[model samples]
Target: MARYFKYKSTADVMADAQSLGHELALADDLSPLFRPVTIGGRKAGNRLLVQPMEGCDGTLDGRPDELTFRRYQRFGGGGAKVIWGEATAICDEVRANTRQLLMAEHTLTGLEQMRRVTRAAHRAECGDDGDLLVGLQLTHSGRYSVRKPLLAMHDPLLDPLIVDKSTGRRVDASYSLLSDDDLKRIEDQFVVAARRAAHLGYDFIDLKQCHRYLLSELLAAKNRPGEYGGCLENRTRLIRNVIGRIRSEVPGLLIATRMNCYDGIPYRGVGEGENFIGQPCPHELPLVAAFGTNPHDHREEDLTEPLQVARDLRDWGVSLINVTLGNPYGNPHVIRPAEFPPIDGYYPPEHPLLGVLRHFRVARQIQAAVPEIPIVGSGYSWLQDFAPQAAAANIAAGHVALAGFGRATLSHPDFARTLQTEGRLNRKQVCRTFSYCTGLMRAKDHPLGQFPTGCPPFDKEVYGPIWKEVEQRT
Candidate 1:
């Protein structure tokens, strides 16, 4: 495998970027990352954000388990002011995994307790939770739903990639699509989930519309007939309705969306083991089943629709927008520029730095398009310890309002706190983007059908044995 993270210092990283003819925004003064930012009339203590990351450790009945509470407690004390909670299923049937957190009346108390534990931890470490903005991301897994493939619409490219657990065969044209009424029911569930989140004292709720989930797939449902497909207006009808209903019903709750600006075509790994390289699946021109992608050339991004969606979301009362790229199940490299691919993934077709630049460029475009709303930027974890510098630079440049961290947070939950006290991240604890967490996420041989994900390399006490078992099995 080709190793990319060889920089010994930030200066070296800058020099490498310079040699690649890409100018990376790196600030010596990281104050931009510490500045307070307002989202939905509420002020976050800092520009640092903990991006929603699922541990897949909830109880089978969809309640937060011990590991779930532990993950949130660490994030709470980690110093990020905006805590974007992980994807929680709006109902039991739509869960992506058996243990995916489900927001329902039966599990509301555990969810509430989980939030309390997080806030308490934050108060204990940071001395107060006044400026803390905690939120939950409500979603329907759609095609990835663990119970079965609950598809919004069928795509020739994506269909073959989905394996039906019952038949142990890839999904074909015979697979049914979710009806309009089904979608409406899902939208209603989102409002119900929003109410539950508000009742639990969550400052905001993210209508999860990213990573090819039901809502995200709907955004690309141009070929599907009816009210929730074809034209952009039709495609966004469900989410817009959900937002309007939440505004009418749950008056005080803030609405947000972790949206996909690009949904590139699926890819497959070729060759064996260490030699595997990623290549896009066969696709025809004008790829109709994807959002924010250049129809003529699926490899490139076309943000016209995404930009319009952002403006619409803002006008419709969306308080914050977390900008992300590519579906993790298909184009993982585009969403996460990692040094090493996950066990099921392939070596990146492009340089990891190039992937990082793509994220910066795309986010800059979206942020520039919608300057009114706060945009949380992703794809920074691969930068390792220098992520804060890049985040500060992006903030200083007005490219993004908040710097969001995902895998990095799993490894170094106290990154923000360390930056505040020590002025830098602990290099030893910084995420190298090995994708071990993702590896765990993909491992389904466990008793619960999914393994909890954490930084096994650093948080060895908890995940080390788990990682060992995964390695042995794989």
Candidate 2:
């Protein structure tokens, strides 16, 4: 719903929203960052971060491109405790787009390249004040792949993504029940890739459990009366098993998982397999939506997974918990606190301020529940002015926003540095003028034109040609 302004005072805004039963999020001191928090018993320098985002500039074989290396190198140098690798698939079939990075085949060589380069660069920069901990985010694109059609947990009900076909426009996805072997192979690949990451000097491997990915599918499998479905245990078994195997494979490395509190739908079990994009299906699987065996009912326990998963993995001595709102396209409302899309999204008034503000509200709730665990957060990162608000959510003042603006960060890799020094706040950075960064995904022909995806416009025009050269595989 659109927020109205009759020129209410800040006090009035607080009172009216409070009287209406909306919760108030506390604003904390972002400067102190975090109290000493340890993951796998190792300290994470400061509470700052470089949360996992989709970095698509890998080589054809999945290696990090030169642009990819330089991008993180600067980010690492600028200073962040942890740097999350873009979502890299465990298998070729699970990649979201044919051009996306993978764990199998060509990716190993590329990852080896990334591991060596990033570690060396990060070391040269942060030094003793911090160690750049690298975490690999393993993901499966499922039905939303920008490539040819492939199997998803649900029936192929959604239309394929529009793309210039090698011939005509080819269907960009496929759907079917993954065999036991399929599940095993993907799991094995995760272990191998995670082990490889550890071998190459990365400190951790983050298993993606949020958004509509493969593990999320298992977490959301509804009502199937089988060993792999229906009950929560059945649904989460794959994640558990994968975790166990990876624990053994990369015993010395830290393991982390990002989880969603809910898929934001009532009665929608584990996401109906996410078959469509704009409006078809969650295709073939269910997603974690609060606490019914499916999405039919919300349970308090269901909402507590971040802590529970943290505890469960803690038993295995795993690492941190990175939290985020997963739905951007399927449920923009998740990020936007409005009863409807805000006007700022259109041109001038479309920012959905209330919705974005609400993300902090959710983060605060999660923090209250698990005060001791190291939690990484997003949804309003570019609002550097929200220093106190970010601290209120328990994120350190030094923390950097993961996906704050499509291009805002590009112009300021030191976005967090500025906030740390310049010091101001803008918790409501979403002014209806901003559109979601939907245009930057795997588009063809024009890699990305004048628009910014998740960073500010590059300050150095020379960086473009340099980046293009890096993207060209050696």
Candidate 3:
């Protein structure tokens, strides 16, 4: 039933790309992916990084639950030198979902245990953990917060999409925006979380600024007045302030960020049943509610400010950067190219290969601009069995410093090891871009309000039953 990804070989994939008027790169020699890269004076074992893939399996009080420990243990042994931890809430009130992890004093022991288990697993599998770099991504969910819709700035297009759980109604003009004072308090929380991460011996802490979360949304608040809005300088004020404080207070701790290079306009499914296709929402332009997007044409990328932000982040002491595209909530295809959509999602408007190419091109621009800093490129999971070849090609061409995998890692944790030892991924385990993990994420009818997401097809033992449950409920 899939329209794309019918290629039997890498050559076939490339030929299809050519037919689509895009050049898809593939390298038979994958050595470029095995080279060690320096980040904050520390050497990661290789250029492969496990992008922060949230499990959403934490406890009610914000501690890593049993499944959380298991997921990280697998990732630890999975062979990626840099295991970027999942997004952990800065405070309880800002959690994106009920089961989202929280980094705080009460949960410090649980976090330490999670790290300990991950490292132990890595050592058990790889024989040593000296070259491993583990980090925790700290975040504030903002408009997506489960408690309520917390706004940084109002967007006519996105505001109507946010249904405040507390009121069970979409937010309107009357919904209060986060005040300057509120942001100051949130900034302090970020610092505190970073300090906690350092105290717990995390290799680094990620200041999450992607996916239209609080900080990401702030980047597009050009029309809003005050310190955290308007011009680029003001728009990036909160992140800049948080980075400065973390550097001053937690001196030796390294800082990283997963930032959005482009935030495309929101889309909605327009057709019936299986025939549904994504269609852009009606909106007036010049679009002022998005970052790295052309105001006159919301669909086209204008990375001038995004490039500058990368440069500024480098100068501001961020050791490395992860470049991502689109707001997952608004435009899933741009962020994650998939063959099939999630249960509540729409078919991708363009070819998934084109979406993957967009990631490579935008990431190449950022990597070139900040040549001194390592840039982790995303959107590779859609490549399926050929992801490694594509990653190698990108690294060889100097398009990106590291190749990050999210859904791929969930399906095959030992992807790096397999590539190094066998030179190919286990085809049986490669994620097919079916969006089964995403379907589990969208299933919120559980007693705890979320189903732990993993590869329901490949990781069948744990997630298979969960998927069955979701099917029954939905």
TM-score of each prediction = 0.98, 0.73, 0.99
Candidate with maximal lDDT:
3
User: What are the clashing pairs of model 1?
Assistant: none
Q: Which ten residues in a row have the lowest lDDT in candidate 2?
A: 339-348
User: What lDDT tens digits, residue by residue, belong to model 3 across residues 1-474?
Assistant: 348988888899899889989888899899998898899999998999999999989998899999999999999998989999999999999999899999888999999999999999999999889999999999999999999989999988899998987878889888899999999999999999999999999999999999999999999999778899999999999999999999999999999999999998999988887679888999998897989999899778999999999999999999999999987778899999999997767998889999999999999999999999999999999999899999999999999999999999999999999999999999889999889998888889999999989999999999999999999986
**Of 2 and 3, the candidate ranking higher by lDDT:** 3
Model 2 Cα lDDT, one tens digit per residue, 1-474: 233432223344445446556644434455455334466677766555665655455665566766677766666664556667778887765766545668765567767777666666657764543445677788876545444433324412222432323345634333245665767676777788788778766778888877656676556555333566766667677778888988776678888877664554321212122221122234333433332123333211235544454456556555666666544444444433332222121211223344444555555555555555556665543233332344434443323222222223344555444445555322233222232223334233344312123321243453444334433522
Pairs of residues at least 3 apart in sequence or in different chains that clash in candidate 3: none
**Where does candidate 3 have its weakest 10-residue lDDT segment?**
1-10
Listed per candidate, the RMSD to the true structure in angstroms reads 1.1, 7.3, 0.9
Assess candidate 1 and give its lDDT: 0.92
Q: What lDDT score goes with residue 355 in model 3?
A: 95
TM-score ranking from best to worst?
3, 1, 2
Each candidate's number of clashing pairs is 0, 61, 0
User: lDDT of each model, Cα atoms only?
Assistant: 0.92, 0.52, 0.93
Candidate 3, position 390, lDDT:
94
lDDT of 1 by residue, 1-474 (tens): 788888878788888888889998688899988899989899899999999999999999999999999999999999999999999999998999988999998999999998998899999999989999999999999999988899888898999988988678789988889999998888889999999899999999999899998889999999899999899999999999999999999998999999999999988999988779999998888787989999998878999999999999999999999999888899899888889998778999888998888888888998998899999999999999889999999999999999999999999999999998899999889999989999999999998888988999999999999999988887
